[model samples]
Target: MIEQDRALYRPLWTVSFDEAVTLVRAGIAAAMRHQVKDLLVDTTALRGFPSPGTFQRFLMAVEWAEEASGRIRLAMVALGEMIHAQKFGVTVAFNRGLVNNVFTTELEALAWLDVEPGKGSPTRRQ
Candidate 1:
């Protein structure tokens, strides 16, 4: 399942091929609905990777999102080597159009998300 939370406008994903696509679709929908120019996605909970075909489909969805939102800045929180690798592929799939980075900690991710200190912290739970 893919759940988008209001907190930090963050999206959390379950580890599955279908859910990954759902996450991508949901992200695009959320961006369009909110007119968001940036996104912080947390995939630390996802255990494995989606299949190549699933990944491609997600990429296609993201490409369409690019047209709607221009260049969206994305920060992904992927705490471990496995998760980091998965996010790396996602960043690469975004190509050069989007600014994407993967981080191991929520603080770093929040910083990259561009929120200034003292404004409020986007809780990691979401």
Candidate 2:
């Protein structure tokens, strides 16, 4: 996890279902604890595993972070193949009243979050 000028960036590298949920939840928790309102979750590594249950895992994580996540603008980064062309997790989260979006790259995610890379402290606060 990398904290920068306007948001916290979490790059998930081939994480399993449980790890993904835990890490994303942790990221949301950290943002809330620090009073930061933006979060970037890069899951571009999750590609080519076509599973309908994947969305359920995301739903679980999102529900677990319901209280804290609603206050944060969450930006997810994933490859086009990984992202469901329809019924994407981002849209579901948005419909549930969370401020969030998904993009194809970190650059797009950062831009969506209005995060100016290298413009602020890149250190994570304990």
Inter-residue clash pairs, candidate 2: none
List candidate 1 segments past 4 Å from native.
1-15, 47-69, 83-91, 94-96, 115-126
Q: For each candidate, C-alpha RMSD in Å?
A: 7.4, 7.8
Best by the lDDT measure: 2
Give the per-residue lDDT digits (tens) of candidate 2, residues 5-54: 34655554665666666666777777777777777777665533344376
Query: Relative to the true structure, how large is the alpha-carbon lDDT of every model?
Result: 0.52, 0.60
Per-candidate TM equals: 0.55, 0.68
Stretches of model 2 off by over 4 angstroms after superposition: 1-5, 12-14, 45-58, 64-69, 115-126
- State in Å the error of residue 64, model 1: 7.8
Minimum summed lDDT over a 10-residue window in model 2 is located at 117-126
lDDT, residue 27, candidate 2: 71
Model 1: lowest-lDDT 10 consecutive positions: 117-126
